[model samples]
Target: MDARSRLSRAIGTPVLFCRHANRLYHRRLGLRRCNAGGVDPFDADWDNLLVLDACRYDMFERRADLPGRLERRESRASTTVEFLRANVDGRDLADTVYVTANPQLHQHRESIEARFAAVVDVWRDDGWSDEHGTVLPETVTERALRAAEEHPNKRLVVHYMQPHYPFVGADADFDGGDFTDAEADEENVWVQLLQGRLDADRSDIWECYDANLDRALPHVEEAMRELGGKTVVTADHGNMVGERAFPIPFREWGHPRGVYTPELVDVPWLVYEDGPRRAISESTPGERDAAADDVVAERLRDLGYAE
Candidate 1:
């Protein structure tokens, strides 16, 4: 955090702390939840790596119905940039193919292309849903299949944007309000949730998040079934839904960079090695579009990300 941000944390109101303090103290203190929590993705054995954006361990455990051994791993970073920076920077990734719905690929496209062999971007503005806020998981799944088939020799990374925000599940138990371009440009769903401005209860908010995952995980299962070799399912980071941070006991929401709390960084690591290939990938960032700079930024903004 900058000097100004730290000072604001020391003096902000409770609601203010809940909304902004998470971003102010953004630094990981190296606290880990498991022994293999922060292992580098490239060093891990596998063929395909499936990334679920902002998925929590407990949430995945509850909803994962795929064929794999499920375990929890501590993510190296809590936000997209940190995840990418910690895992991909300074690494050799020429044999990797990234199929992503997340906008981070476009934001850091040059750096990613520098390390990885190829990137199949599926985040088109044509797929935007006012209710879903980003490209759906199936879009990622279809492109990932083609990418894997075309680049059989390279490692494949499939990144999905879901269970993060703009929650969409068939149950439709909770109304996520409308995250239209204008609404997302103003404030994120997390801030609205923390400020009690949204139309759901705290528990409902979390349920909505889980519901969003439900909408995404089936496509993950589809990829595991189609891809060859060992496939590992994981997340860039987890979300913070009313979790309290230490030292001040302040409540937190959203996945903010620099946070080492379990809620923000602990993600599911499910191995679907039923012949699915394995590989490597992270440096942080997110959103979707036809790769326009401002349109990509708009996707990130829709996800409650400021970068």
Candidate 2:
């Protein structure tokens, strides 16, 4: 077995948490990328790819009112790191520019550089949402617009961190952690719902989720309109709100990777064809910028992840 597989097995994160956590830890270790673990980005045929973080197929099917051909597709992984490793790693990203607001990508920023061509990380200080901890859709829009213009020779992959957590539509902020203190961090919706701080049926909580998605959609629309190619709206993975992942049989609140249930892995593949395809003019390799480790650590902490 290769070192990556041997180390992944040694860690036992896949069996412990799921394949998702294993992938996360693997990426953190700077191990060789694994294509056997998940989806390949180049498999899909599109010029512009918009990934809505934690967006589900059913939720999107019911809520996405935008103009596009919506289809359902199975996702390879059920979490952020898995998605990144599966799609971005081991790919020829020389002609691709990734514009994203998801800090999960930032947490594993180094792995991203080795795999993809360029990444416009908008989840940094200037774009960071003090209220949300994640960059808003508007921020993603501006950066995606900029990335598209800057990397005219590469395909654009705009990833927006909305419909994910720390619900911005409603005041679902996580300042000090006072949750059930489960395996999940205090900030995520899973902990809040488990603690009775948030209600699932109530419109306020659900409405906030809807509003966050709404807030993100327009910016993606703006990017699609400006980029003008075979733009597709999709997601890295889906979310789980009180859905019981079979075999586990208990009620699950948030999307935890490795539990390959339909709710968490089944995502929407919406295609938005804007005129004829435009050929990218040039190619730039992905580069890693000098980042403050402490700043990134704190950002991960705020996002309810281990630093």
TM-score of each: 0.81, 0.79
Native-vs-model 2 lDDT? 0.69
Most lDDT-accurate candidate:
1
True-structure lDDT of candidate 1:
0.71
Give all candidates' CA lDDT scores: 0.71, 0.69
Per-residue lDDT over 220-302 for candidate 1, one digit per residue giving the tens place of the 0 to 100 score? 89998898689899998888888786444666677765666888777888886674334433323223234568887877776
Candidate 2, superposed: residue stretches over 4 Å from native: 1-39, 110-113, 172-187, 192-204, 281-286
| lDDT, candidate 2, 1-307, per-residue tens | 4556755653763232333343355344345333234455557789999999889889888887888899888777777887877776656677777787866776776665445668787877798877656677888889888877777767888888888765665543333442222224635556456445554453445566677687777777788788888988888888767655555355556666455577877788888888778676445574567668788776666555541
Task: Report, for all candidates in order, the number of backbone clashes.
Answer: 27, 2
Model number with the top TM-score = 1
Residue pair clashes in candidate 2: 117-286, 153-282
TM-score for candidate 2: 0.79
